[model samples]
Target: MTRLPTPAPEGDPRDGGRRLMLVEALAGRWGWSPRADGDLGKTVWAECAL
Candidate 1:
């Protein structure tokens, strides 16, 4: 089983910044595109088969 570290408080003096950096990087990697970026609009629909 994988164990994730407990979330740190927003103002932890020692590790908060480090934790934020990790989270931000992961979010960018997996998150959806911002509405204003690229060619995507408010909705996108597609169909395909793998």
Candidate 2:
């Protein structure tokens, strides 16, 4: 199973950049690829198929 860092709100410029960097690091280091992602009111999530 792949693990993703808890997401940061995209509304903040700094957090948005940090979120992208985390994703990139996971992709580069572990070959993790996101299959889908979205916001659900109070919650947000991204999934990757193994």
Backbone clashes per model, in order? Answer: 0, 0
Query: lDDT per residue, candidate 2, 1-50, as tens digits?
Result: 75644446656665333455565545533333454464321222344445
What are the per-residue Cα lDDT tens digits for candidate 1 across 14-46?
A: 643345445544553322223565553322223
- Stretches > 4 Å off in candidate 2: 1-15, 28-50
Off by over 4 Å in 1: 1-13, 29-50
Task: Please report the TM-score between candidate 1 and the true structure.
Answer: 0.25
The lowest-lDDT stretch of 10 consecutive residues in candidate 1 is 40-49
Question: Could you tell me the TM-score of candidate 2?
Answer: 0.25
Q: TM-scores of all models?
A: 0.25, 0.25
Error of 1 at 12 (Å): 11
lDDT of each: 0.41, 0.45
Query: What is the number of residue pairs that collide in model 2?
Result: 0
